[model samples]
Target: MIESWRWYGDLDPISLSEVAQTGARGIVTALHEIPYGEVWPSDTIVARKAQVTEAGFDWLVVESLPVHEHIKRGDGDLSELFANYRQSMANLAANGVHTICYNFMPLLDWTRTDLEAPVAGGATCLRFEAVRMAAFEVHMLGRRAAEGDYSPDVLTKAAAWFQRASEADRDALLASIMAGMPGAFDRYDVAGLRVALAAYEGIDRDALRQNYKRFLDEVVPTAEDLGMRLCVHPDDPPRDILGLPRIVSDGDDLAWVLAAHDSPANGITLCSGSLGANPINDVPAIAAQVADRIHFAHLRNVTKDPDGSFEEAAHLEGDTDMVALVKVLLDEQSRRRAEGRADHTIPFRPDHGHHMLSDLGRDMIPGYPLIGRLRGLAELRGVISALSHG
Candidate 1:
């Protein structure tokens, strides 16, 4: 696989030289300065590519060219937004960017309740405790029918978690959940937050699935025409959150997505942390089954607790078998090479590392501190090297 790291460009506290030092040859980034739904001009693409190339790294993939809000609703100027997205993909291809990774999660992007949950090794990491999340929904934000999303036991746990939270903790929890807002519900006010959560009251898993299908129908053809691979990243926690449905969690979901578009261009990003967050996901099997359409990868892990709580783990630790999963990707790469594909290796980045070492005290984005991801990239590179040699 092409070793890469996710860079937020110049705005990221972690510099490009630091990323180059991490042993990654490629960068996954987007021009975040541009507003969503606007066309990413060819000049901007060229300039961004030049920036990464100047830093001694290739632009591996567009971490996202965001799916616009109108497109999500399939109304209110959606055609224009979709046209802009298509033009952006075409512009990206012309500028030598090939793989485009995106997500269809409504409202927030991959969300979590706690950005610094304590782990045993003295390093705190990003976490998604179902109880903390439910507490926010039921007690803090008060989303109607939020109780239906959790089982009785989980609800009990959430109630207990809320009871124990200090006022500061609850406030921080809200901030963490709303951090780096993405998709339909960014910039929500207090009343807007209520309406936003309430809006999902009747949209079940199947309805969200239909919306995703609608999205792919518009973009996948353009992606195919321009030789771009469209990879949909799975839901971060691999489950429903705050009464919202998650569509890209399991095999069945993937099957439906692939069948919906019926094109190789519409594929999966195959994020290990996202899928492995659910204990039921057979990681190796999941990768193998989706190998043909696996255009990008995000390699990371978490220590899953039975109480529906989990904290991010180092790349080599946690329940995910890093080597076994890499082996699956490697085999897929080898097979593709054998068939004379243009790009054999699946593009991957070491995702969501701990904020540790010198990065521990830095008030950077949660799970994106430099030294921590540097360590993760090194670990993943070592595992891949060993597996390739073995």
Candidate 2:
């Protein structure tokens, strides 16, 4: 694996020089300055690439080239949006950035209920509690029919959780879920959330899956044309949230997607933290199945609770067997090497690290504190080294 780190442009507190110090030679980033569905100017792409190059790092992967709400909802003028996306792909390819990672989760990007849940050893990590999410949906967002999705027991627990949550807790929970302010829920207010929820009111799982297929059918050809790999990120939590549909949660879901286009360009990002949030997803098994088509990876682990809550754990100390996963990745790398594939060495980042060390009390991007991710990278490097040689 080619180790990389995610950089959120100029506003990111961790400078490119700082990222280089962590021994990450590749940078995984996107144009957060550009709004959703807009064309990323070639000038901007070139300038950004130059910035990374100057920092002694290669811009190896785009963490995302967002698929806009207009496309996801199967509403509005898709032709214009599709054209813009295609142009962005062309611009990125022209600038030498070939792998693009994106997600199709509606309304929100990877969400969590708590951004600073205290963990053992006096550190903080991101967490997703199903009951708390349920509470947000039923009592906060007040999405109609949300109560029906939960079992009687879970609903009862959710109600109790909502009752006990203080005002500050409620605001924090709302902010955590609305991270990045994905277009559909950009306003981040109750009314805006309701409007966004209403847009997906009639769309069910099957409809959403069909919409995802349509998106691939239209975009995958362009990706292949530009010699770019489009890797779809899995839905975080890998389950329905706020009564919305999530199709890319499990192996079967990914298999369906790979089958949709049957091309190498139609690949997966394979985020372990997102998929592992649901205990049912076997991370190593999924890695094996999708290894061939995985263009990018986000390798972090999660410790899941029986009540469906999960906390981001250290790289090697969670529910996932990081060593086994690394072994499989190494095997895949060997196979690719034998095949003489240029992209044989996959690019991956130590995702969602805990807030620890000097990063404590600093205003930093949650899950992306400098010292914690450096620790994760060091831990993962040891595993990869041991597995590759042994």
Total residue pair clashes for candidate 2: 0
* Tens-digit per-residue lDDT, 21-114, candidate 1: 7888999999888889899999988999999999998898998999875555545457788888899999999999989999888777878888
Q: Which runs in model 2 stand beyond 4 Å of their true positions? A: 183-185
**Model 1: residues >4 Å from true position, as ranges?**
183-185, 199-202
Writing each residue's lDDT as its tens digit, candidate 2 over 167-275 gives: 9888888888887365332656777888878899789999898888999998999999999999999998788887789999999999999998899999999898888
How well does candidate 1 match the true structure, expressed as C-alpha RMSD?
1.8
Model 2 TM: 0.97
